[model samples]
Target: EAEAVLGRVEDVAGLFAETPERSADSPGSDWEDRLRDLAVRAVLGEPEQAAMLARASARELQATLGVDALRVMSGSISYVRRFWAHNLKGAPKASLEAWFEALTEYAVALSYSRRLCTRSVACAVQRERPGSEGRRLAADLAQRGDEESVDYGATCTDAYVAGDRVRSLVNMAGLPNWALHEGDEGAVEAPGPLHGCASICFNKGTVVLPLTDICRPRDFEERMCGRGKPCRGFAPGQLVRSLVSAACHPRALARGLEGRITAVDRTRGRVNVDFGGTNDNGTEGALRVTLLLSDVSPVEEFEAKLQSRREALGGFFVGESVRSLIFLPLQASRPLLFGAEGVVSMLDLQHRRVLVRFGGEEPLQVLLRFQDVCLMDEFEARLQERRGVLAGPLPG
Candidate 1:
């Protein structure tokens, strides 16, 4: 298991190191040191190193890892300065079971550390690669230096920065919110004057969901909520609460909730959405999803009415939990529903889709249609509570 983990780590790290920008720098001078520090922490759960495992490489460390009586005794030693600081006469005795337990903890920590290292390197290299087509287009507009403001269309993030060169974005969870700085005035807060509302900025895309869309609900489809009851229309930045049955895709419990609209084509009756920004799956580009405008009536503005938890929340939190299987049809005769339980790793609103990663030793990422996935039943109550908070109405 340790060997397999080491191999995977090396493979990912090698790829990251070989990138054009990274290759110019060669092996980081402190990379090995950092790895050693991580290994020591994993093994000892502290900075202090055992006598036998001092300064060990991943391979060497793996070989030395074990909590057998002999191994523990060999690794644990106290100093005796009787004759030029000779080693202790005998190793501290411990039960095999205890040793084994300690060893297991170390191994788990080591594996975790390896994963962290691989992910860190991969993220650094990813940013150097080319961005999505829409991102490139936006970057181009920003480069032209003539337009006072560039419009990336509705339901999209990755806001244009005036002079910043186009840079690649990597998928990693828990990164500090991306902030735009303006001279000495300090960090520019979200939705700053650009659009009037709260927004979140990502290294790859900036979420600019319009505040108006959030405030005023649009009646989208009558059949979605239930028969004869019109469901709300999703705006450019809003999420698809349910699937469009006409799209020929089965409803997935969690996948449908992943997408965020990036662009909407009224003439063509199509919307572009992107998924995944929450986990190791990285930020995949937006996909063009066809909206059944002919069959389904267009979203119409509705009068605001005070209600309890029935109101909709415009979007979902990235990295939300989801079931493994999804409903995707592979053939006309039979629909293929395949999926492995995973988390909503990323959410691209512009080109609607969600990225999911199955839990395992090896990292695996898959993309599913945004509309097909739905929030799990267990989460419905929580979703309603969040909606109540965002929509600002008391529940009955």
Candidate 2:
């Protein structure tokens, strides 16, 4: 009975799998046509026949793929969804849409138990790199003391580069350790040089993920600052507005100083602004000054804007006193990460601190102390009142 059921299920699954191709050939082909064909062939007819077909398919799938295969395929589907979803949060809409299509093919292939075949093909593609080619690329980078090539080989287990570096993702993984050249052997070790060189290990396959996509420890540090001090009460949109206003301020305009926003801290109500400086020719050179928001805004405006901005921004809002919680707005700048160039706004309601994050291929967080802020106007006082409401005790 079980064998019979398995046969029935396999028949239905096979038919369903072919439906797409059939429909493409004959536009009029429909699900009913497929079902009717199955029904006519079965000894058991109508509803019973359809039901039997489904049950058999399920049983056969379980038998052929096994529970572990099914589980892995299902998990891969979920992982693909989660990976893209997380990426969509920070990526531009157009880029996200493009990646969505690219990942769909990867996700669909991963859904099959046959994904190992696909992975094998991808791994084989590494053979196209330099050293794996006709001529072996010399390891000149090793002599130059370049750590990047070494780290790349360690991280990816495969790399290939022409010119100065002996980089190739393929041969590096399996090269014999003793075959490596030993320089400075028995010579006096230089100050920073180690006694024994660290050889690259290629036993395990490297899991290559885009560095920009992975959130590193440094990103958390840049967003939170040292000791994980959260940037409180700042939102990205508000910070943008603040920079625009500050750049337009009379004194700033008089000096031809336009503020370029680098980071926003919603939690602490701070903005990191870059003040453009004049060059020898009287044209603007690179920006040199970082003005805290407190130094630019009228005290009252700065305080008032924080609450108003919090309401406008709207992602996550937190505060201690109604006057000082970080109001996270809906729109957020991308977080600091390798190869990521843009601004980020951080808010920490608990400490009522906000940090504006900026710079480096690797992210770095710098805290702006409230004491460091030079208040500008009466607007600060009014902002304090609104913040009071956000942070105040709730009604019973």
State the lDDT of candidate 1 residue by residue for 8-70, as single tens digits: 444534553575432212344333444444544333323223111222332342334421211
Best by lDDT: 1
Number of the predicted model whose TM-score against the real structure is largest: 2
Clashes (N, CA, C under 3 Å) per candidate: 32, 52
lDDT of 2 by residue, 1-396 (tens): 121122344565556557653321244443234323323223122233333332333344344543232233334446546765786788888977766644443332222112222222223222232222212122333444644334321211111111111111111111222111111011111111221122222123222222111122223333323212224433222332232222221122222223444445443344544443456753233332323444444333554655655454332222211111222222234333212222324555456444444454544443333322212342366446555866964221
Predictions: Cα RMSD each: 26.9, 23.0
TM-score of each: 0.17, 0.20
Question: What would the TM-score be for candidate 1 when compared with the true structure?
Answer: 0.17
